[model samples]
Target: MANFASTADLEEKKITFEEIAENVYAYTAEGDPNSGVIVGDDGVLVMDAQATPIQAQKLIDCIRGVTDKPIKYVVLSHYHAVRVMGASAYGAEAIIASQLTYDNVVERGQQDFDSEVGRFPRLFDQVETVPGLTWPTITFEKKMSLWMGKREVQLLHLGRSHTKGDIVAWIPDCKVCFAGDMVEYGATPYTGDAYLSDWPTTLDNLMALGAEKMIPGRGEALKTADEVKAGVGGTRDFLSDLFETVKKCVADGKDLTATYKETMDIMRPKYGQWVIFDHCMPFDVTRAYQEASGQEHPQIWTADRDREMWLALERDQSAA
Candidate 1:
C-alpha cells in the first residue's frame, strides 16, 4: 500500500527568495505552494498569500529584507484556501481577486479549507492563525489594470485554467508574469477545481502575454523564455494527458477506482518525481472524470467528500 500524504510529507522544505526581475521575487519552498512579491515604486504587490498567517510572515520577512515598501495590494490568483488565507499577514491596503473568485469563497471556501488541511496538514503550519475565509476588497470581471506608482500590473482572467476565478498578473514593462496556479514548472498542477476542456486554451492566452520570465504557482521561477515556455507546455501536457486518460476510461465504462489506477500507471512514469504527484493525481483524476462525464461546473468538495474519495481510491483497492 502507498503511504498516505500525511506520512509521505512530514519534513518541511527550505524556502528560497529569488529575484526573477528587478524587485520581483519568487517565494518557492521546494514544491510547496508559492507566493510572488513585486516591489513597485511606491509600494509592493504580493501575489497569492501563503497558507496561514504564520506561513505568510515568512514572506513578509523576505519582502522587508529587500524593500521597506508597504504591501499595497494582495492578489488572489484563485480562491484556494492555501493561497488566499494569508492576506491578513500582508497588511496590504487592498485584497484583489476576480469576481468569480470572491463568489467561490462565498460558495465553497469553508469546505475547501477543511478538505485541504486534511490532505496536507504540514502546509498549514499554523492553521489556527488563519482568520476565516479571505475576502477580496476589490474584484474585476475579465481584466483590470492597476499601478503600483509608475509600474503597471495588468490582472487578466484569460478564460479559466486552474479554476473559474483564476487570474494572472502581468508586468508588461518587466516582461515577467505572476501565474497563480496556471503554470507549474517541475510540479504537478492540482486540478480538483479545474476546467479541463478550457485549460489548454487558457494556457495559450497566458503564453500570448509573451512573458520572458514567469513565476509558476509552484516550483522554482522560470528565468528564460525557453524555460517559461517549457513550464507552460509541461502544465498543458499534464492536464491534457490526465484528462485524455480519464476520458478513455469513462468511455470504456470503467469505475473511478479502476480509472484512477490506470491514470497513476500512465502519469507516474512521466510525472512521478514532480512534487505532489501522488497527492494531487487522485484529486485531479476525480475532477477530470467529472468533466469528461459532462459536469459543467465542478462539484464542491467538502472535507467529508475528500476522505470518502481518498479511501475509495488511494487506500487498498483489494479491500475496496
Candidate 2:
C-alpha cells in the first residue's frame, strides 16, 4: 500500500457530486473511489458501494440529504472489493449482479477483498466495518429491468470490458448510463483481468446505446452527449495505444521490464498525467504483454501479484 499510486500519499477521503441528467447523479470521491446513486420513484438504487461500512454510510447520508426514499436495491457493477464491500450500509433488500460477476465473487472475492483493502488503506479506513464479502442475492445472465416509481431501469451486459461480467445500468428514457469501469473520465481504466481485444467492441456497443449522459467508473460525470463519447473514446484510445505499443515491443522480443519501460515512455507525453496512470501502467503493461504473446484472456491479479509487478516496474524505473 505504501507505493500504491491511488493515494499518492493522501491520508484522508474526498467526495464530490455532479448531476448527469434529469434524475441521475454521480457521487465521486478523489477517488475513494466507487459508489454512484440513481434516484427513482419508489426509492434509490446505490451502485458500487465503498469498501467499508463507514464509507458506505457516507454515501447513504448523502442520499438522505437529497431524498427520503428507501434504498430498494444495491447493485454491484462487478465483484471488485472497493466497489461492493460496503453493501451492509444500505440494508438493501436485494443485491444484484450478473452471473459472471457472481462467479468471480465466488472464485476470488476474498483475495480481492484483502488485496484492495491493502492497496487502498485510506479508502478502507474502517476496514473492520466491512460486513464481509458482498454477495448478490439476485443474479442475471444478459439483461434485467426494473422500475423506480415511473422511471425505467435497464441493466445490460454489453460484453467483457473491465471485467468478465462487466455490466452497465442504462436509463433509456434519459439516455444516461452508469458504466462501471467500462469507461473512465479523465482517468486510467483498470484492466487487471480485462479482455483488451474485446473491450473496444464492448465500448462500441455502449455507443449504440446513444447515451447522452454517463457516469464513468471514476472522475466526473459526463453530462453532454459529446462529453460522454469523449470519455468512452478516451478509454478506447488508451487501450488501443497501450496494446499497440506493447505489442510492437513484445514482437521486438523486448523483455517485460524493458517493454513496460519503453511503453510508459511512449505513453507519458499523451497520458502520463491521467488519474491512476502510474498505478495502472504496471498491470496494463503486464496484460498487454501477455496478450501480445497470444494469451487470450488476462490472468487474474491478486494482492501478491500486484506487489510483484509493482516492485519489478519500480526497480526498472529507478535504474532508468
Candidate 3:
C-alpha cells in the first residue's frame, strides 16, 4: 500500500567521485549505495560493484577519468545483490569475497536478487544486464592482503554486523577503510539480513582499525578521523537502539505488529532525517524482532516475504 519498498523513490541523485586519500576514491550518490576505488601502480581494485552492469559502467567511467589502469580486481564486501551483481561489468581478473559470502551466494543469491530489485527499482536500472549471480573467484576465511604495487590493501572480516560476511578493505598506507554496509553516514542501515545482536561488537572491531578516513556503504565518504568516528558511532547507535527496543517489546510479549509500532514511535523522532529511514524501518524492525525472539540466522528475504512483511507492518503508512 505504501508503494512497497522504495518503488516510489524515482528521483535520481547527484553522483560524486571524490578522492579521499592519495589513490583511494569514493563513488557516492546522494544516499545510494556507495563504491570505493583504489588506484594502484599496475592496476586498480573496485569495492562493491553497483546494482547492474550499466550502473557499474557509470563507476567505470569515473575511474577512467582518473586512471587508465586495468580494473584488475573486484571485491565484494558482502553477499547482497546490490553490492555484487554488477561485478561482471568490471571484467576484472578476479572477484574476491569472504568464504561465508560465497556460501550465501550459493544459498540464496537468486532470492535476494529478486527481493532487492523489487524494493529498489531505480537502483537496478538495467537489471537485465546482470548475468545471474556474481560468484567470487577467490574467497578468504578471516583476512587477506593484496599488494597493489607498493600499497597494501587488507581485507578483513571483523565480525558479523550488517551481514555475516561483511568485510572492510583497509589501506594501511592511507589509513582509509572501505567499510561496506557495516557503517553508514546519515543513512538508515538496511538490516533485513543482519545479525542485530552482534552488530555493536562488530562496530567496535571496525573502530579498532583506527582508520582516519572511511567510505561507508551508503552516504558521503568520511574524510577525517572525527568524521569516521561519527559515522561509526551513528551506525552503532541506530542498530543498538533498534535492536534493544525490539528486544524489550519481545520481552513484554508483544506481537510483531505491535512491536513494530512501538519501535517506530521511539526511533522515528531521532533517526527520521536519515536517508531511507522510512523504507528501512519495516525490514530492520522485523529482523530485529526475529533475532530478539531467538532466531539465530536471518531467514532469506524473497519478494513475497518482502510484500507480506510490508503489508503487515506498513500498510497504514503514507506512500513512499
Give the Cα lDDT of each candidate.
Answer: 0.90, 0.85, 0.92
lDDT at 4, model 2: 73
Which is the winner by TM-score between candidate 2 and candidate 3? 3
Q: Pick out the ten consecutive residues of candidate 1 with the lowest summed lDDT.
A: 1-10
Please write out the lDDT profile of model 1 over residues 82-201, one tens digit for every residue: 888889988889999999999999999999999888777787877988878898999999999998778889999999789998999999999999998999989999999999999999
Q: Pick the winner on lDDT between candidates 2 and 3.
A: 3
Question: What is the descending lDDT order?
Answer: 3, 1, 2
- Judging by TM-score against the true structure, name the best candidate: 3
Model 3 per-residue lDDT tens digits across residues 1-320: 44674788899999999998998899999999999999999999999999999899999999999999999999999988888889999999999999999999988999999999998899898799898899999999999999999999999999998889999999988899999999999999999999988888989888898999999999999999999999999998898899989999999999988888889899999999999998999999989989999999999999999998898677544332
lDDT of 1 at 246: 98
By TM-score rank, best first, the candidates go 3, 1, 2
Q: How far out, in Å, is residue 227 in model 1?
A: 0.2
lDDT per residue, candidate 2, 27-55, as tens digits? 88764465678888878998888778888
Off by over 4 Å in 1: 1-7, 316-320
Q: What C-alpha lDDT, on a 0 to 100 scale, does residue 240 get in candidate 3?
A: 84
